[model samples]
Target: MGKNQKKKSNKRFWWVLISVIIIVGVGSSLFFFNFFGIGIDALNNSDTAGSVEQKDLSKKEEEKINQVRSTVGESHQDLGDFVASTHEFYNDTTGYGGINNLDWEEQKNKSEQVIMEIEKLTLDVSDESLKQDLQSILNVSQQAIEEEEAEDVRSLHRYFHDLDIALNDYQSYDRIWNVTETLKEVR
Candidate 1:
């Protein structure tokens, strides 16, 4: 009876040891290969699944940030062109036209289109000052557009001056610099 009991205990010990070794080996391999699902399946916990999901979410967010940054960079370049066109309307005199005789509809339409593009971009900035700066730009831009559409020469000229200043500030803004830094990190 004693011998039989000893043999049964030895068998149980070996079985448990082997099971543990197998589990440890598989877990190690899965971790090495980045197959984290094994942890979730074997452990029956949500930690691994949650972490994987978080990583995927972060990747999506990074992609969105990159897209916005690219669009904003392109838009910034176009902004300079818009300013030039506005300047040209005031400076270049054709044989048929002169200063103060300019039709601003074309420029207004272009500005509105660019504004729509900017509105479509997702700006998830956290800084209060940056947010205010962006708001100022939007406000000034809308005011300028309204004045242009109304053909209010006085207000339009004033708003255009304000828009120019806002745009210049945006060109060297901290938020844009921060975005550039973030792009560097993602790369």
Candidate 2:
């Protein structure tokens, strides 16, 4: 090729390269900053993303809290009824000698139903400690029922005492807490 032609070709190549570089740089910058408001929208939309995510997390946490509250509330209602029923049963059966008779069997069946109801409670609690505490109460109640069925009044009373402690713990776990009523309300 001629020298002038070669020089002109080289100049054109350099101009194209420079122009391409500039275009690419500007386009990439715009895309990264979301100046055109396209794509994921989360890429560079602002700090609202954090806030949005936070709000979502907050909502989920609230839902969990409500669920736990509901379970606890159900527990309270059932436990109150159970306590009353048990006290009445104890009083009624004082002369029966043991809980092995038909009347005691009926009471035992009712207690089992209560246990099942408690088991059916949805426990979506976030706090591990609270969950453990609630589970402890359930365990005690189960043991007490078992002891009562075995016709061991002393053991039943002991288990009931432990259950009472767990119940107290649950009550003191949080003040102004009302779970059963909330569950009723939700339903």
Candidate 3:
């Protein structure tokens, strides 16, 4: 009986040891391969799934894109000029007070004019992304107008920041820099 019990104990110990060794070996191999960046491509199908190559645009498509880009660029420039004029009017102390003392009614009128100009500007592009961005800009502009009407300076500033981001032309560094400058001026 004692011999049988000893044999059973040894068998259990050996089984547990072998199981532990196998587990440790597998875990170590996974860690080693991952650390060395080995077999990672084989294990990960993410690159294949996520990396979609864009097809080359046709002549007509290229023309359309260029037209949209030009329109967006021109519109941005015109709006920027108008905003600068508005800023000048706001900062001017000839008739009113300085930057510290703004005429809310005059500011509201200027914002309304901006909204009107924004409404008049049309994208006429089929690109969903551009259309969405334009819509976001319009929405934020409207919100900013509302904040201006309510005389909420802080909320107006926040909405103006959102409007600047929404107006970002991802292709132009100059546009980004200009937006940054405008934001600094606003502050």
Candidate 4:
């Protein structure tokens, strides 16, 4: 071929090559985005499902409150054991205060944990009224604990007393059910 003719042929070859590359790249990207979209959709669905399962939001808020009550039952058992142990130790040692000063410190720490945990009890459910009620319960418990712990005690009796009342409200099936039933009625 003549020099100009040969140069034109090479230029055409390059154009064809570039066009093929562009077509393939665009096609691949479309496929990738389509598949990626499905993956993202699946992930979102599972995340929502997992939240419901983990929080037991599928059941009414009342049921979740009832579960909290059962947990308090175990906590009561533990508290009773702790009180007995402290008493036994105090009796075994002459002039020993009912429970050492350190016990109070530990309980004070526990008070914060309890307050934060109950406060953060996420009601992902959309019932604003139920959420407010749960917050009220937690607030009362937090206030009682704060007041009780501010006092110095020879024993853990007062601390446990406040804690028991806090748990009592949480464990009351009738009370929680009534509130939840009311909420359901209004909704």
lDDT of all the models against the reference? 0.41, 0.43, 0.44, 0.40
User: How would you encode candidate 2's per-residue C-alpha lDDT over 1-187 as one tens digit per residue?
Assistant: 9999999999999999999999999989877545443334334422222211112224444454456545553455545344444544543543232232325465456556646755654244444444454454466556656665433332333233223323332231121212222212222
In candidate 2, the residue pairs with backbone N, CA or C atoms under 3 Å apart (3 or more residues apart, or in different chains) clash, namely 73-179, 73-180, 74-180
Ranked candidates, highest lDDT first? 3, 2, 1, 4
Best by lDDT: 3
lDDT of 3 by residue, 25-136 (tens): 9999888766644444434421121122323334554344345445543456654444345434433421121223345676566667756765665444344544444455
Two-way lDDT contest, 2 vs 3, winner:
3
TM-score of each: 0.27, 0.28, 0.31, 0.25
Better of 1 and 3 by lDDT: 3
Q: How close is candidate 4 to the true structure, as a TM-score?
A: 0.25
Q: Residue 78 in candidate 1 has what lDDT?
A: 48
Candidate 4: residue 85 Cα off by (Å): 35
Candidate 2 segments whose C-alpha is farther than 4 A from its true place: 1-104, 122-157, 165-187
Relative to the true structure, candidate 3 reaches a TM of: 0.31
| lDDT of model number 4 | 0.40
Clashes of each: 0, 3, 0, 0
How do the residues 1-187 of candidate 1 rate in per-residue lDDT, one tens digit apiece? 6999999999999999999999999988878535322332334422122211212225554455446445543445445345335433422321122212335675466456545744543254443433443454455557646775322332223233323323332221122112122233333
